[model samples]
Target: MGYGLAVLGLLLVLSGAPAPAQTRAQTQESNDAAEQELRLPPIGSPAAEAMARYAIEREKKEYRENIERAQEVARLSAELQKAFEQRHGLFPDDLRKLERIEKLARRIRSEAGGSDGDDEGSDLPKSLEQAVRRLANVAKDLSERVEKTPRQVISASVIEKSNELIELVRLIRRLS
Candidate 1:
């Protein structure tokens, strides 16, 4: 009991609280001294505050751009799905747009901060991989049809692939 009381007394002393009877003037003088001692560097110095602010702003811009890019990809996917549902052959422009969307998705997956790491850490990578695989499978299936009937490769069979693409777009939007 005595040892415990002594330890508690030592802790109280080490805590550096003011004595209970300290006068107002002494308190004010102590506060001024503490402020003077703890003064920061000059305002214009190369402080981490400025760097942190810039980094935060840059991340905000990147995140906003990522969301916009994801939305654009979703829109393109919808256009492709519509064309497929209409039973029209994919034009060169549609092919180009698909390529562009794929490129943008890859860029977002590789460069986005929260998604650059492992697949287990973020669903974006896994969804992106699945989307790419599904697209490749569709392309392969179409190419096989091209071997069998060269002119009929772009038929109603693409509707299923278009649905998969739409789901991929939804995943991308969720990521953003």
Candidate 2:
């Protein structure tokens, strides 16, 4: 009788234990349900429509801001180029322009999805004039690239160019 009772208790305990496969299936189902709950509403639903409109408006605003920053970069670079041509080297007063160019380039780089990181090595310009000229050319290229890129796109080339322009501006600032 004791042996039969012990066997019955063990059977009950074994039956109550959840099987690993069954537990995993339950967890997967729970995860799927949670994911479904977090998903966007179906297309044509009011919530979905509102989300779409908001996304479009936000994209348009970002696009306008990007264009403005790129244009400012071009203008500042051109001014630097002109100053160099006139004086043959940057004057103390021209440091402000370089600072502004650096600021604008930083903003443009961030907006284009770039992070502050060491740029790939390149030969440093031998003179202030050469650096300024390179800066002007790069700024122009950056402006054109930004204008050509669609609002929905994140451009690697634009980010690379911005980094290059920023480094040149910094080098010029330090040398001046």
Candidate 3:
């Protein structure tokens, strides 16, 4: 008990007495840091303040322009889609694929037609769904025609590639 008490006393004494020089050195180091910070240009410096303001304004301008460009792209694409539908009765690429499906991994996007600006898995907006369903019907008809005519399947049909596209659609449907 005496030995334990002696060890506890020693610990308490050591803890209670921090070397004075350590405190002095710490204060001097803090003062040096403060002096360095003070030597830097204050916010009152016109050039530094102007540069900061300019950077902020430039960033704001860039953000605004980006938004405007995205909106313009959406508008233009919608216009192009309408034109394509009017002139060709379906997506232009779909028409091309009907004519020749080779050398093109079926550019038919998951959503179909031009970009409608929908995020991934955003429930496939009703209009986009209708368009995709329409294309699916077209693909189904083509698949049937190819099956009916074996020689045509070898000659007129893009069987292997179309099969891949059909498989991809099936996978996407399962995922959604």
* Among all candidates shown, the one with the greatest lDDT: 2
Each model's TM-score, in the order given?
A: 0.40, 0.72, 0.32
What residue pairs clash in candidate 2, if any at all?
Answer: none
For lDDT, candidate 1 versus 2, the one ahead is 2
lDDT (CA) for every model shown?
0.52, 0.87, 0.43
Residue 151 of model 3: what lDDT? Answer: 30
| Predicted candidate 3, C-alpha RMSD | 19.2
Which candidate order results from sorting by lDDT in descending order?
2, 1, 3
Can you list the residue pairs that collide in candidate 3?
Answer: none
Ranking by TM-score: 2, 1, 3
Can you write out model 3's per-residue Cα lDDT over 1-176, one digit (the tens) per residue? 99998887788668865444458778678889999986746677987788789988885665444333323323333443455456644455543432332112232221122122322332232353344443344344444433344331232233332444344333333433
What are the C-alpha RMSDs, in order, of all predicted structures? 16.8, 8.3, 19.2
Compose the digit string of candidate 2's lDDT tens values, residues 1-176: 99998887788668875444467778679889999999989999999999999999998998899899999899889988998999888876688888888898888888888879836556669788889999999999999999999887878998889889988988888777
Best by TM-score: 2
Model 3 ranges off by over 4 Å: 1-40, 89-120, 125-176
The per-residue C-alpha lDDT of model 3 at residue 6 equals 88
Clashes (backbone N, CA, C under 3 Å), per candidate, total 0, 0, 0
Whole-structure CA lDDT of model 1: 0.52
